[model samples]
Target: MYIPLFDIDGTLLKGGGGNQAHKNGGSYAFRTVYGLDDKACWDNIITDGKIDKQIILEVVEKNGISHKKALAKLDEAIDATTSYYLEHSNEGTCIAADGAIELLEELQKQNVPLGLLTGNIEAIGIDKLSKAGLAKYFEFGAFGNLALRRVDLIEIARERAIKLVGLQMTTSKFMIIGDSTLDVKCAKDGNIPVIGVSTAKSSSQELAEAGADLVVESLLQKDDIVKFILD
Candidate 1:
């Protein structure tokens, strides 16, 4: 049988701050709009309730820096923040939830083919798995940068797995295991079962509400994660 597709943040790697860590904070936004350095811009953003368009225009007009530059800097800052969190969390070490890697290993030994489907960009996702020495476990996978929505990229993963591994697995054989409501929605949109692991922000009940076929609070117990897939 084809193995399951897993999500990275909040699913496999613990403490790798998810979307909240990725959002452009008000301070960061203000910095970009005002062309100010990190400290001064952040100080105003934190104290001010709203960012003024006048301030943005004032900075842009005065600095004579291209608007594109500011925009690019904003994107860069977001990536930098994400990278900082990834580095601090020691994502390179894996540090997955209890039995997370072991469960994948068990499935691997059983000849099940596995893949990854993460919301993280390809480079960041690959580095995390590689550092954890878990990259070899997945011969195929998809990353978030492909599309804005997870469902759009879930299909990408299926197609890649079929082509790269020459496996003719269908939606029925495909499964997604993750820790959030988005995972359930993404899998359902792709017409597959989504196994929700409640080890992160999203609880089992929330996942159920979002349409998870099966929910596991923790996969540390023997055969728990494996049986969910095969059963």
Candidate 2:
């Protein structure tokens, strides 16, 4: 019952954020409203380097929609993107993190149960993983747009994992892998161990500060990562 929940962006997927097209396009709605497209703004305000209420407000303001309305729009956008990408895969638009596939293969071989818990909406999340051929690795997942807060998705993921595995899994059986402080907080809130990877916005030191159980520089270090997680 060792359920390892992985975050796609920065954890298993690297560079430019997974499903960049979706975020980039949607972010324009915000940038157009506030002229805040700079990296510093996105890194500091939108993602908060950590999950908090300020980040939530930024998301709403950026989108030029009420939080409730934004949630609805996010759902629609995800569904649309998922359908489009699934239909038009193999164009090389979707990329997987280095060593991500190999690590997943190894985990699968060991019969370690796997699932996805991401801040990405369903359409965007499924499209990225499906395109990268990593979708099959997960038994189920929780999407960001499904709820207002990342912690809310944790329960959804927990329920899905239980249903998929047909058994109850304790927090000790859970491990969340991601690159951001947001990922760290979500896992901590869920009362699970977190494996942080510095493949996205956050660094190893930052992840450690955010309370990551283990922070690796890259998933490319397959032997070390495997040993660290499986040890």
Candidate 3:
């Protein structure tokens, strides 16, 4: 069986990140935890594909906060962001990407080793999936808090999946599902193929240009995606 590690925001749900509210909430967490509040500091913190610890470290150095102090408050910031996302999601969140539920459901039917490799921190990632009622599909995941680079998380997920499902996993048999060039590069850097979904801001052609192995307009495509996973 193939193991498919998924990305949450753009790949699974619409408008999951890169919005005003989430950006503000993340920035707020940094300020509250480290008292590191500067527009430039916040901007450096949550750029494309950055992890939580990386964000904290940069914010600390750029803003002159002690590294030890930032490390000490990292957990507080993490919890604060979790609270922020959970509370804000009530208005309207987790609009499952077109075909996301369908695709995940079919994958589950085949007993594919489904796991997450996402930039969302663990707390927020779990909450997003749980609130969307999609948590059951994911058996395990590599979240942003675990590693700074996305490639690192791919390896982490691969190791976990091996133990989680007893699969003799290989890169050729692994696939990363996501929506950005960063996602494509993450998998490519790990010597794995990426299945790109353009339901997010990136277009199909853009994903293809990024060297995505397959660029589908949405997961709902009737084309046998399982073939991508299995054949």
The top-ranked prediction according to TM-score is: 3
Q: Total clashes, candidate 2? A: 1
Candidate 1: TM-score?
Answer: 0.70
Error of 3 at 166 (Å): 3.5
lDDT of each: 0.65, 0.68, 0.75
**Candidate 3 residue lDDT tens string, 48-138:** 5556667666777668877777777777777786677667756546666778788888887887878999888887777767767778898
What digit string (tens of lDDT, one per residue) describes model 2 on residues 166-217?
Answer: 7486556767888888889888987878888888778889999999988888
lDDT of 1 by residue, 1-231 (tens): 446888876777775433333323323544544445644443322111111232332344345556666544544544554455454444124556677778888887778888888766666567666666677788988775455457776678878988999877766788888887877888888888888888876887898999998888876753867877777
* Candidate 1 lDDT for residue 85: 42
Cα deviation of 11, candidate 1, in Å? 1.0
Between prediction 1 and prediction 2, the one with superior TM-score is: 2
Candidate 2 runs further than 4 Å off = 24-45, 48-57, 62-92, 228-231
Model 1 worst lDDT window (10 residues): 45-54
